[model samples]
Each structure stands twice: as C-alpha cells, then as structure tokens.
Target: MKKFATITLMVFTLLIGCTPDANITSPDESTIKSQAQLIKLPALKSGLKIETNLTREKYINGYNGGSFIEQFEFQCVTGNVIINSQLNFPAGAFSGGKTITQTFNTETASLEFGPAMQFNIPVKYTLTVSGLDLTGINPETLDFVYVAQNGSITGVEYDSITMDVATGTLKVTNAKLNHFSRYGFVN
Candidate 1:
C-alpha cells in the first residue's frame, strides 16, 4: 500500500510539472510585430479637421418614487476622431425626471453638462478624448479640471487620468460630479 501511494504521488507531481503555468505567457511573433508597428506609428499632428457630434441619449424613469441606476455613453465620432463620455447615475440620483445635455468643445478640449444642478447622489463621469494633437505633452502632468463659466479653471480631486501616446487619447476615470458644469483635462 505504501508503494502504491508513492507511485500516485509521483504521478501527481509529474502531472503538475507538465501542466503549463497560467500566469506566464509569451507573446507570439505576430503580436510582437503588431506592437512594434503601433510604436512606429507617427504622432497625430495638430489641425486634423476632426468633426464632433452627439451620438446617443438615454432616459430613465427615476421620477415619482421610482428608483433606477443607469449609465449612458455619449460619443462624437468622425473617421477616428472620437470624444467618448460616460455618465453613471446612482440610484435615487434625481428626485424627479430630468434631461441632461452634454456638449463637447473640440477646440478647448472641454465638455459641458447643462442644466447645472446638484444631484442627491454623486454621479461618476468618465471621458476619453481622442484625435487631438498631444505632442510634447506629458500625460503624467495632466489633471481633470473644472472650467467655470468665466473661464477660470480649478483642479478636481479624486479622479484618475491616463493617456495613450500612440493614439493621442486622454482618459479621465471615476470623476465624481455632484453638480453639472464644464470639465476638461489640463496639464
């Protein structure tokens, strides 16, 4: 019986040794080549003539004691020029039915949420700005800022920002919005 148990343990060890490690992965040559190509791509220049528009709208029935949580993605895309913005409204965000308007200004790289009002719960807003010239700008020095009506800017705390140099896309995630206003990225 001891001999049989030893053989079984040896077999289990061999099987474990033969199994591939899930945590370790090597990229294929094709994937490496594609990554190289992406690295070699030219930087997007300024004045690319990108157009913008509102691409989506969603309505939720949160009025009259109804509770709902909804997320809406609004995109302005034109031939690779994309301004994607997402708003996640928490449950019981509004006391009544409300219409929110979003506007993106490409020239200043700013976004405006109209009907400036505070919510019962904070709404999360994420923005990804693409198809703009980001040359000579360091992504690490960027911050999400609130642009006031008088053009004054203030840095908004508690937001995460990331940038892709290859695509010239800057993204701000988890920006909590208690009130609607103009927001944008700044260095």
Candidate 2:
C-alpha cells in the first residue's frame, strides 16, 4: 500500500509538470539585430508576380527646376520589386531655387527615393508597401510618404499557395517628415 501510494503521487506530479502553459510562444525573441546582414545592390530583377491594381495622385514634390507631379498605377501579372535608388543632396541649407541633387535617403526626400525596408520586425510579414513619399509644395519643406501593402501570410512552405495572392492596397497616411528626427523614421 505504501509503495502504491508513492507511485500514484509520482504519476500525478508528472502529469502536472507535463501540462503546457497557456502563454508559451514559438518566437524565442521578437527583435532582430539590424546589423545581421546588409544588402546593397544597384537593382534587383522582378517578374511582376502580382498585377498591381492601385491608383494615386497629387505627387508634387520639393527642390528647384520645373516642378512636376507624378502619378502611377500598376497591375502585377507576376514579378518582383526590381528597383534600386540612391538620392544625395548638397549639404547645408535649402533656398527657393537651389539645385539640390536628390538621391535615395532621408533629408532631401523625394517621391521615388524614400526609406529602405527594415528586417527583424516583431511580426512575420513581408512589406506589401513600405517606403516614404516626398510631395512638398515648398522647395525647402519635405513631405513624408508612407506605404503599407496588403498581404496576410496564411499558407506554409509545401502546401498550396491559396493565401499568397496579391490583392494589394494603398492607404495614404498624409503626413510630413522632419529631417532632424530622421533616425527614428529611416535607417
């Protein structure tokens, strides 16, 4: 009887220990170090994987020269995003008609050359649309262009790609950018 009671207590303790906690998660850590890897290439190839059904307007921006507004929409039959941009502006202040060479980076922002994509995010998501937009009326002031594409990863590695469809969206979060507080915004 004593040995049986001891064995029963051991079994009960083992069962209690094996019970899974309610808050256990798969991701051991959420934040990924930014310096893990850095890819710098002039451009990458693309094949228009998803036809982009998006329309946008009012893309007037800053800097001198004849100011023009650009608007574009694309439908992705199938391809990858294959564009590399580098924007550089003359150091120092800006004037009414200053000829600043704008490149892909913060500060002298442009519609095309915005922020770069950031990895090591808390969630597992590929950016549908992640970048900035420069549509400034004044040649000095720069507007922040932000984009977030729509895509929810539901399927797995070998299963059917039912959830990989690209029915994207463009939500304009009308806002401006400050160059000083740039590190918090861009790289």
Candidate 3:
C-alpha cells in the first residue's frame, strides 16, 4: 500500500506539472514584433485632406494664367497607396469670368490627391469614386500631369511623395515649388 501510494502521488505530480495552460503564450518576442511591423510613412498622416485655391502668383509664360482649387486625402494600413496629380484651369471660367469649380468624391477605403502634388502620399488601399463634378462659367481646360505616375517608386524630387507600395514605407523629399505651369492651362 505504501509503495502504491508513492507511485500514485508521483503520477499525480507529473500530470499536474505537464498540463498546458490555455492562456499561456510563447516567450518569443520576435513573432509579435514581426507582426507589429506597420507602414511608417509620415506622409500618410501629414494631411489626408488638402484643399486650397490656385493663385495667380506665378505664370508659366505669356498666356493668361488660370487658377484652380485642389484637395488631397491619404491613408494606409498594410501597404502604401497614392494619387499624384496636376490640374488645369477650371471649366467655364473664361465665359463667366467666375471661379470654376470641380468636386471629387472617393468612396473607397483608399486615398485621393488633388491638383497640388505636395500632398502625395503612400499607402495601401482601394479607390472608389463617390462623386466627381466640374462646374464653371467658361469652363477652362484641366489636365493631370504625372510628374510621378501612380505606383511609381522613384525619381521624385520630393521625398514625401516617394513611398514603398509593398512595405508602406515613406520618405519626405524637399518641396518642389517651380515644377508647375500656368499659361499651359489652355491645353
């Protein structure tokens, strides 16, 4: 009986010690760190929304310069996404001599860029058009010049505009103020 009791106690101790707890987690911290790797592009948060009026402060050449209003928005979760753009004169401005208006709506979970390239962001997302409209008196022409096309990962004079689509990494380059044209609004 004494020997049997000792054996039973030993078996019970082994069973209690070997049991695995459901709440116990692994001590390896790298696994969590690897998963925590998030896209850190600062431009992603700089300003998702950009709205400004185009001014006649500068002109491309001898042609009549047209002003424009622009807006930009950005966001990223796993990857990077961006919209780079350039805008021409508003439509119907020449006829009415009034401010031409353009409205853009993005309903997707992605980002959007306006006439100003400064707000270009890198993020991973989808773009859905919620609404888009252009209205003005004379209705001047408008164009989106691709200084850096969408998904382009190189040669941006500004670091902020450059971003990694896979890793969601971002770099903010210097501001490029002189790249846009004025009188070219005709085209």
Q: Give one clash count per candidate, in the order shown.
A: 0, 20, 22
TM-score attained by model 1 = 0.60
Candidate 2 lDDT over 31-96, as tens digits, reads: 221211111111213443432222122221233213222233222223222222222222221223
Q: Find the candidate with the highest lDDT and give its number.
A: 1
Q: Report the CA-based lDDT of candidate 2 relative to the real structure.
A: 0.25
Return model 3's CA RMSD, one decimal: 21.6
Off by over 4 Å in 2: 1-68, 78-94, 98-111, 114-167, 180-187
Cα error of candidate 1 at position 7, Å: 85
lDDT of candidate 3 over 104-159, digit per residue (tens):
22232122232332212221111121112112211221211122333321122232
Those runs of model 3 whose alpha carbons end farther than 4 Å from true positions after fitting are 1-65, 69-71, 79-82, 90-93, 108-187
Candidate 1 lDDT over 36-84, as tens digits, reads 2111112224554444423233454334323222222222322245667
- The alpha-carbon deviation from the true structure for residue 94 of candidate 2, after best TM-score superposition, in angstroms, is 4.3
Please name the candidate that would achieve the greatest TM-score relative to the true structure.
Answer: 1
TM-score of model 3 (CA atoms): 0.21
lDDT of 3: 0.29
RMSD of 2: 16.7
